[model samples]
Target: MTSSVLEAQKLGRKYGRRWALRDCTIEIPSGHVVGLVGPNGAGKTTLLKLASGQLEATEGAVTVLGDRPAATPARLARIGFVAQDTPVYSGLSIADHLRLGARLNPRWDAAMAQERIARLGLAPDQRAGKLSGGQRAQVALTLGLAKRPELLILDEPVAALDPLARREFMQGLMEATVEHEFSVVLSSHLVSDLERVCDFLVVLVDSRVQVAGETDKLLATHYRLTGPRRDTDRLPADQQVISASHTDRQSTFVVRTDSPIHDPAWTVTQLNLEDLVLAYMDKHTADRRAALEVQR
Candidate 1:
């Protein structure tokens, strides 16, 4: 098997006349909890669906666990997906779901499923439709975990949960990760939630991948530089500017570089994950404005 859990090459998915996701290229390494962060309408869900084989790409290719997604029963079985709503069969009881999982998944862990339901204090006979939203989410997550997949993709799985429920769900996920050595790609608009769990980060904006890398490496390489007003062209070529703003007397820029910044004229500050994500997102917005202006 390939070392990468998921790989997308110039992947594009269009809806009607507009592309929901386009020119996306990313390779997610195995054994890391990856966070896919973006705003609403950012194609976060589209990309996840492509990876899980729920949607076909209009252009390019996407591979999950080193094989083309949904290539065969075995390939499809290797991935577990929990969508934004944490969909569950409303008519089925929690126990019925377990039985279905066992009947369908070759690698289903019946013991794990029973233990998780018991620990969560969910009644075996409780129909999914009767459960609270959070409870239903838990049941969906339990089913995903019990499938014993090599890779799991979650698309805003806790977006509708209460704060306490969200915390509990995340806690259970972390515990399961510790117990099972599997890869996860979790999509969320909430950066704070991702900060607590993911080691790898991918920031998407306007249906494009703005930046992607290990969280620690990204944090180390990105910085905010403040100094006297200067043209962006004057900055060192190696320092890639993510965003820039200027006043009459000063210019501030967010840049990514591995080289040391020894400029005595500038004051540099380290950026947290939120800062970095916003910087890239803002840059994309600015670029769009510039493009529109040029057209006019």
Candidate 2:
């Protein structure tokens, strides 16, 4: 059995009275690519911050490689984070940034960093601010990769790049993960990027984790069922209704269950990664509506 590199137990962070992440629990094993998916204000950033040890959990606990996230500097060094904006000092040149990272980080690999920069055709003396958006993102990624961290977390790393650049950036990540043994968790709004590179997924909505699991396992467990309307009471307790819609003669439902269905009456269809996430988001929205009505 593979060991988990990171684990969160009822982890959470609150700002004043609002919870940024509430009861978010997940175990991420090593050597897997995890795709973090969520819409804006879903606390994706907050979760990443907590996991990266950049922010302390307000309640519960989080462990990085069997140690408290903040307890071990060595463990913290084992993780690399590319934040939402992909921060790079504008005043510093590309080479200056690399040099600083090499000097500051104990695990920085100079040869690997240099090779990546050369491959990208980035000049050492070029100011980061002078580079194009795509180039700047590439520089940030190069720095993160060269750190040789056991866990790499990227927040919207490709959001600034164009389609071609995004593809290239993901390819770079793939190569890094293949050549190096490490676990990666990257957040992106682009489902296509996640589909191409990640085998694991975590979906967050409204400051709560809606789903988290192996990508294939999730896809296998969830199904789109369409058939004539029937009493929901007939559905087994194990089958969790994620979202449901009904017309006079037809009913469609997205459900998650462990049971297998081979019946002909219900047409079972596969769901793509994007549709799967949206189903959870829609369910959350509906639940919120019901809560507001109750308060009224």
Candidate 3:
């Protein structure tokens, strides 16, 4: 089994009266590509910032590589972060960024950085402000990779890129992971992109972690059951219902269980990653509705 590269316990972050993230607990295993999936305003950026030590948690704790985040120089050196905007010095050239990276990081991979820039066809002397969106993103990614951290955290890194650039970036990221044997935690609401590059998955909704586990295991265990309208209480306790919908004549439930389902009264169908994620999101929506009803 893979050891956890990043762990959070009851983690939370608040902005004034609003909670950006709350009761968020997750474990990202070492040496695997993990995907953080959530809609806008889902606290995905907040969680990533916490891991990168850019933002302090309002409560609970977060650890990266077995040490508290931002606790020591060594701890900080072990993580690489590329923010959602992929910030770069607009006035600086690509070579200038490499020079700055070498000065700041003890383990900077100068050769690797140079090779990647060459491969991307980015001119070493060309200013960052002059590059296209995709080119700029590539430069930012190169800088992150060259730092040679044990864990790399990316926040919606491809959201602004064209489809082709996104594919190339993902391909490069995968290759780098294989070559360096490092772990990654990438945030994106686009299930299609995550599906291609990540083996582990974490789904967050409404500032809380809905579910997190290995992608294959999650897909294999979750199933949809449909049949005559019936109360959920009638199903075996072993079938943990994730989401449910009902009509006068029919009922449907998304469930997770380790035991084999043999009931003839229901039709069981498997869920793709997108389907599974949406079910959890729907469950969260239902929970909010129920809370509102209780308040009335």
Among the numbered candidates, top TM-score falls to 3
Query: Best candidate, lDDT-wise?
Result: 1
Off by over 4 Å in 1: none
Window of ten residues with lowest summed lDDT in model 2? 64-73
Each prediction's TM-score versus the true structure: 0.93, 0.92, 0.94
Clashing pairs in 2: none
Candidates' RMSD to native: 1.8, 2.0, 1.6
* lDDT, candidate 2, 1-296, per-residue tens: 28887788888899899998888887787668999888887888888889888998999888876777773668767889898767899999999999998987899999999999999999999999998878888899988989899889999998877899889889999999999888999998777888989999988887677888899999999999999896566777888999988899988888999899776889999888888998998999999998999999
Report the C-alpha lDDT of model 3 over 169-253, residue by residue, as the tens digit. 8998998998997899999999988998999999999778889989999999999999999998998999999999999999999
lDDT of 3 at 227: 97
Model 1: per-residue lDDT, tens digit, 143-262? 999999999999999899998898888889999999999999999998888888899999988778889899999999999999999999999999999999999999999999999899
lDDT of 1: 0.92
Candidates 1 and 3, the one with greater lDDT: 1
Deviation (Å) of 192 in candidate 3: 1.6
